[model samples]
Target: MNTTRKLLVLASMTSLVTGCTSLPPDAGFDEVSVNVEQRIANKVHWYTGGEEDAQVRQSIHDRLAQPLTADSAVQIALLNNYNLQAAYADLGISQADLVQAGLLKNPVLEMTRLKPRNGEDASLDIELRFEFLDILLIPLRKKVATQQFAAAKQRVTATVLDHAALVRKAFYEAQTSQHMEDMFREVTSSTEAALEAARRLRKIGNITAGTFDRFQLSHDETRLSLAQSEMSNRASREKLNQLMGLWGEQTQWLIEGGLKPIPFKPIDVNDIEKRAIANSLDLAILKHDIEALAERSGIENVKSIIDDLEAGYAWDRESSGEWSDGPTIELRIPIFDFGHARRARVAAELKQLQDSYYARAIEIRSSARALSDRLQSSRAMVEHYIDNILPLNRRIKDNELLNYNAMQIDVFKLLRAHEKQVASRQLFVQALRDYWLARADLETLLSGRANTVSDMRGPAISMGGGNEGGH
Candidate 1:
C-alpha cells in the first residue's frame, strides 16, 4: 500500500478503538447522585455554568423565605453552597482525565529538505508517526482512569454529605444561641426589678446598704451575661448563614424552632461497626485507588519488557519526480533503564493503598463504636435535664416566690432563687445543644465520612452567687 493509504488505515483503526471505549455522557454523575440520595435523602446537582436550571435556584429561595428547619437548611446548602459546588467541579476534572485517557494521541508530522553540493533541486522527505504502543495500552489506561473517576465521584459525594452535616449542626447551634439570648434577657429583666426594689428599700432605711449593693452587683453581672449571650447569638447566626451560602438580606432568615428534643427511644447500635464498614465511602475510594494502582503496575510491567515502540509511514520525492513510500519503525533499546524503577514504584504505591484501605476500615469501625456510645450518653443527659432537673428548678423558683410574697424571706433571697433557676435552665439548653451536635456527628459516621465529633462545650452559666453574701 502507498504510505498515505497505510496512514489512513491506521487512523481508521484508532478511531474505532477510541469510539468503543468512550465513557457515557453523564459520566457516572447519576450513579453517584443515587448513592448520595440513599444516604442523605437529598439529591445533588452539578452546575455546568449557565446550564443550571432556574427551578433549582428558585426552590432554594422559596425555602429560605420561610422559617428554616434543619432539613431545609441541609437542602439549601446542598443546592447552593459554593464550596460544595466547587467539589462537584472536581468531578468534571476527573471526567476530563478519563476522556483524555480513552483518546489516541495525535499523530506527529515531520518534513526534511536535502540539497546536493552539485546545486541540483532539493529532495523533500516527509514522515507521519503514530505512537502505536499507546494504542496497545489504551484499554488498561482507560480501566485505570475509570476507577479513578469513580473514586472522584465518591469523594465529591462524601464532601456534599459532610457539608450537609455541618449545616445541620450550625442550624441547631444558632437556634440554641437564640434561645439562650432570650433566656438571659428575661433574667436581666428580673435582676433589674430586684435591684430597683432594693434601692427603694435602702433609701427608706428598710434594707441595709450592704444588701442594696449586692442587688446592684447582681444586676451588673446579669447585664454582662446578657451582652455576651447576644454576641454568641449573632456569631452563631452568621455561621449558619455562611453554611447556607447566604449573605446580605439572606442573613435575616429566621429559625423555625429551638434545638429539637431528643428522640423518645434510643437508636439501636447493634452491629454499627459492621454497618459502618459496609457503607464507608472513604474505604471504597481507597479500594478504587488500589485497583487503579494494580492496573498501573500491569502497564509498568509491559513497559519494563519493551520501553518504546513507534510505527509510521515515510515518503520521499526526488528532483526528477520519482517517488518512494515505505513503512518506518522506531524502537528504544532498554540498555540501562528498563522501567524497573517504575515497576518498583507502582508496587510500592499498590502496597501503600492496600495498607491504607485496611487502616481506614479499622478507623471507621472504631469511630462508629465511639460515636454510638456518645450518642447514647448525650441522649440520656438531654432527657435527664428535660425530664428532671429543669422541672425541679422551676418548682424551687415557684416555692421561693410564694415564700417571699408571704414576707417570709427578703427580696435578695427571692432573687437568688430565680438566678439559680435560670442557671439550671441554661445548663439544660447546653445539654440539648450537645445532644444535637452528637446526632450530627453520628449521621456523618453513618454516611461513611470520618468526621470527628464537634466540641460540645458552650458558654458558662453564671450562678449569680458571688454577691449574694452581701445580704
Candidate 2:
C-alpha cells in the first residue's frame, strides 16, 4: 500500500474505535436505579450536586413528617443515609473509569531542530506517535470496564437494599424496646400500689413485718427493671435514629407500631436458598470480578510475549532541504521480565474468585435454612405465649382475686398473683420481639448485609402456676 493509503487506513481505524467506545449521556445511572427498584421496590437517588438535592431533601422531610413506619424509615435512609450515598457515588466513579477506558491515549508529539556546521540551512523534524497496540486493546479494555460498571450497579443496589433491611430491623427493635419499657412502667405502678397497701396493713397489725418487706422488695425490683428498660429503650431509639440518618429533631420521630406476633406461614426453604444464590449481590460481584480478571488475563498473556509496541508516522526535512515522510515503529524487548509472575497472579486471583463464589453460595444456603427454621420456631413461640400462656396467667390472677374476696387468700397472695400475671405478659412481649427480630434476620439473610440479629435471647418464662409461697 502507498504511504498515504496506509495513513488514511490508520486514521479511519482510530476513528472507528473511538466512535464505538463512547459512553451514554446518563452513564448507566438510570439502569442502576431500575435494578435497585426491582429489588427494593423503593425510590433511590444518585445525588449529583444538582437540583435533585432539593428534591431528596423534600422527600426526606415529607417521609419524616409522620410517625416512622418500617417502609418510611427505609425510604428516609435511601434518601438521606450518608453511607448509602457513598455507595451511590461509587457508581459515578465506575462509570467515569469506563469512559476513561474507552478513550484513546493522546498521541506523543516530538519536534527537533538542527543547524549544520558548514553554514548550511536549519532543518526540523516532527514526529507524532500513538500507542497503536492500545488502540487494538480498546475493545477488550472497554468490555472489562463495562463489566466493572455493571458490578458497581449491582453493588449500589445491594447496598440500598441492605440499608433498607437495616432500617426495618432497627425500627422493629426501637418499637419493641419502647413497648417493653411501657410494660415495665405498668408493672412498677402495680407494685407500688401493692406496697402501699402492705405498709398500711403492717402498721395496723393486720400483716407481718416480713410480708411488708416482701412487698417493698418487689416494688424496688420492679422499679429497677423499669429503669433498665428505659435505658434499653433509649439505646434502641438512638440506633434506629442513626440507621435512618436522623439527627437532632429528626431523632425525636415516633414509631407507629410496637412489635406484634407474626402470623405463621410456611416458607419453601429450597426456593429461598435458590433465590439467594441467584440474586446475591456478593455472588454477582464475584462473577463480574472473574469475568474482568479473565479479560485482564488475556491482555496479560499478550503482554507476556510482546510487552509494548508503538507505531505512527514521522516527517523530516534534512539540512539540504530534502524532505522525508514515513511510518515509525517502537517495541519493548521482553528479555528479563517475561510476565510469568503476572500470569501466576492472575491465575491465583481467578482461583480465589471461583472458590469465593462457591463459598458464598454455601453460606447463603445455610443461612437461608437456618433463618427459615428460626422464623418458624419464633412464630410458633409467639403464638404459644399469646394464645395459651397469657390467658392462663390472667385466669390464675382472677382466681386469686376471687379467693381474696372470699377471705380464702391473703392480700400478699393476691398481689403475688398479679405480679405473676404481669410477668407472663412481659414474656409474651419478649416472644413478640423475638418473632419480629427473627423476621428481620431472615430479611437480612436474603438481602445480603443488613442489620444483624441481637445475640441476646429472651429470658425463658416457665408456664407453671403463680407463686404460692408469698408471705
Candidate 3:
C-alpha cells in the first residue's frame, strides 16, 4: 500500500511538471517569410517613413498589392495591418479561454490516516473524486464566452473600417500636396523668366526702376512659395508612409499616378439611409456590445456568493487490510453577501447599453443627414467651377497674356494677370477636391459602393469583386 501511494505521488508530480502540451507547428518560418517577401515584391507598395525605394515598393506590393479601393480598404486593413493582426491574436486567446470555460473539473485526490489512541495499528485511507458544475450552468458559461468573442470580433472590424477611412483621406491629401508642389515649381520658373526680362528691359531703358523692383519681388516670393510647397509635399508623403506601417529610413516614397478623375454621381438621401441601416459596421458592433451586456446580466443573476454543491464517488484501502467505497456529497450554505451587488451592477450595465445604443443610432442618423446635404452642395460647387469659373478665368488669362505681348499694358499688369490666373486654378482644384472628399464622406456614412476615388473607374480588381478606388 505504501508502494502504491509513492507511485501515485510520483505520477502526479510528473504530470504537473509537464502540464503544457504542444500544438502542431504552424507554417514554417522560412516559408512564411518567403511568402511575405514574394507578396511585397509582386503585390503593393509598402511605405512607412522617409523616401520611397525598391524595398518599400516591394513591401507594399507584397502586403497591399491587392486592390484596396475605398470600399475594400476596410477589409484590407483588417487582413493586413499589424494592429489588426494583434487583434487576431487576441481572438485566439479568447477562443482558448472559451475552451477552458466548457471544460470539466479534474478530480480531487485526497489522502488521510486516522489513528486510534489505544490501538496498535493505524488505518490509512485514500479518496479520489471529480465534480462538475450543474449542466444548467454549462450553457450560461458558453453564452458568456460567445458574447465576449463576438464583441472582440466586432471591435476588430470597426477598427479596420476606421483605419481604412483614414488611409483614403491621407492618400488624397498627399496627392493634392504633390499637385501643389508641381504648380509651385512651374510658377517659380515663370517668375524667374519674367524677372530676367524685366532686368533686360530696364537696362535698355524700356522699363522703369519700379517695374524691375516689382519683378524682383515677384521672383523672390515665388521662390519662397516653391520651397514651402516642397516642404508640405514631403510632410504629406511621410504621413502616407506612416499609414502604410513604414518606419525608419528603410523604404522609398512615391505616390503612384493614374488617379481617375470622374464626375460626381448624384445619390438620393433615402437610398443612402437605407444602405447605412443595412451595412454600417458601427451599428453592427454596437448591437454585439448590447448582446454582450445582456449576457453579463445573466451571469450576475445566477452567480452564487457562498453556496456550492459537490458530489462525487471515492474508494480507499486502510493499512489494517480493510477497504471502504462510497459516494461523497457536500453543500455550502451562504452566510453573508448573497451576490446582490453583482446582480445590481449587471443590471445597471444593461441599462447603460440600452442608452448607448439609442445614442449611437441618433448620432449615425444625424451624421448621415449632414453628409447628404454636404454632398449635394459640393456637387453643385464642382459643376460651377468646371462649367463657368474655370473656363472664364482661363480665357481672361489668355487675353491678358496676348495684350501684354502686344505691349498694350505694362509688366506690372502682366504680373497681376499671372497671379490671378494661378489663384483661379488653385481655387478650381480646391473645389474639385472638396467635391471628391464630400462624396467619400457621404459614402462612408451611408456605407455605399462609391466610398473610394478608385471606384470612380479604374482597372478591375482580381479578387473579391467589388467597387475599387482610392480617393
Candidate 4:
C-alpha cells in the first residue's frame, strides 16, 4: 500500500480498537453485587467474633483449632475470606441477569412531516415497531438466567466446603509440627543428661570417650530436628492464616497444640450415603447445570429458525401530509432463515446435559470409593501405633528410669530409652494426623458431615469404642 494509505489504515485500526471500549472488571457481573448483602449476612455467628484479649488469645486459638464433630472451618471461611466475598458478588450478578432476561424490548418510534411549498399546510406520519424475538424468547432467557443463579449458589457452597477442609488439614499439619518439636525437645533434654553423666563416668574411668562423643552427636541432632520442626510449624500456620484471609504481618495466630481427642463414634455409612446424595454441593451444581442445559435446549430449538412477523401501521394523511384517520398493516414472512439451526442446537444441548450427568455420577462414585479405602487404612495404622507401639515404648522408658535410679544401668541407657519413647510418641502423632486427614478427605468426597478424630480432650481415643480402662 502507499504510505498515505498505510497511515490511514493504521489510524483506522487504532480507532477501531480504541472505540471498542473495554468493559470495567465488574461490568459483566453487576448482578452479583445485589446478592452479596444476603450471603454476607448468612455468615454471621458467635464463632465469627474477633479475638481481643492478649492472655486469652492462645486459648481462643485452641478453641478454634479444637476438633468438633462437624467442621466449622468452612463457616469461618465463608464469613471471613475476601475471595468468597467476590463469589457472593457473582451470585448477585447472576440474579440481576435473570431479572433482565424477563424484560421486553422497548418499541421504536418514528415521525415524519412535510411542508407544502405553494398554498397549503403541513402533514405528519408516525410509525412504531419492535423485535418479535423480545416477546417470544424472553421467558426462555429468564429460565436460563434463573438456572445460572442456582448454579452459582451451588458453586459458592462447594467453595466454602473446600476451604473448610483445607483449614482442617492445615490445622492438623501445624499441630503435627508442634508435636514433633516437643518430641525432639524431650529427646534433647534426655541426651543432655546422658552426656553429663558420661562426662562424669569418663572422669572416673568407667565410660569411654567414644560413647560420650556419640551422646553429644545425638544431642546436636535433636536440636537440629527441633529447629526444622519449628520452621515447618511456622509455615503451616502461615498457610492456615492465608486460607482464612488474614493478610500481611497480622496473619500470625496462637496455635497451642494438636487436635484434642474426641470420643470416637463410627459413622453409619448408610446415613452418610443418604446425606451426601441429598446435600452434596457438587451434585447440586451438576443438577443445576442439567437444568440450564435443558433451558438452552429450548432456546436452541429456536436458533436456526428465523420468524419474520413484522407489522407496521401507515397513516393515510390529509392534504399537506397532516394526521390520518385510519391505518394499514403489512407483514413479512421468514423465507430463507428457517429453524433448522435451532433444532440442531437443541439436540446438541440435550446430548451435552446427558453426558455431564453421567460424568458427575462417575466422579462421585470414584471419590467415595477412594476416600473409604484411605480412611480404613489410616484408622488401622493409628490403632497399631497407639495400642501396640506407643505403650510398649512407654514401658521401656519407665524400666530404664527404674534401672538408672537403682544405679543398675548408666544414664546412657536412660537417655536411649527416652529417645525411643519420644520417637514412638512422634509416630503415634503421625498416625493420628493421617487418620484425621483421611476422615476429612472422605467427608469431603462423600459430601458428608466432617467426622471428628478428636473430641474436646487432648488424647487419642480408640475408633471402635471407649475401653473400660484408664490410659
- State which candidate has the highest TM-score: 1
Which lDDT tens digits does candidate 3 get at residues 413-439? 676667677777667666766766776
Error of 4 at 157 (Å): 1.6
CA error at residue 55 for candidate 1, angstroms:
1.2
Which 10-residue window in model 3 sums to the lowest lDDT? Answer: 455-464
State, as a TM-score between 0 and 1, how close model 4 is to the true structure: 0.73
TM-score of 2: 0.87
Candidate 2 C-alpha lDDT tens digits along 1-471: 254575577667766666644446666678877876777678877677798889889889887789888788878888788887677777777887777776777667788999888899989897877776676676677677777888777777777777778788788878878888888898898899899988888889998888789889989999999999999999998888788788988876777866654755554456888776776777777777778777877777887887778888887888888878888999998999999997887788778778877876777778778888888898888778878898899899999999999999877788778878877887887777777777777766666542332211111111111111100
For residue 228, give model 1's deviation from the true position in Å. Answer: 0.9
Clashes of 4: 17
State in Å the error of residue 228, model 4. Answer: 1.3
Off by over 4 Å in 1: 1-7, 20-27, 49-52, 453-471
Local accuracy by lDDT, each model: 0.79, 0.75, 0.57, 0.59
Residue-pair clashes, model 1: 0
Model 4 off-target regions past 4 Å?
A: 1-75, 111-125, 197-212, 247-252, 271-275, 307-319, 324-339, 446-471
Model 1 C-alpha lDDT per residue in residues 392-458, reported as the tens digit of each score: 9889889989999999998778888888998898888898888888878877888877765321111
TM-score, one value per model: 0.91, 0.87, 0.74, 0.73
| Per-candidate alpha-carbon RMSD to the true structure | 12.0, 12.5, 10.7, 15.4
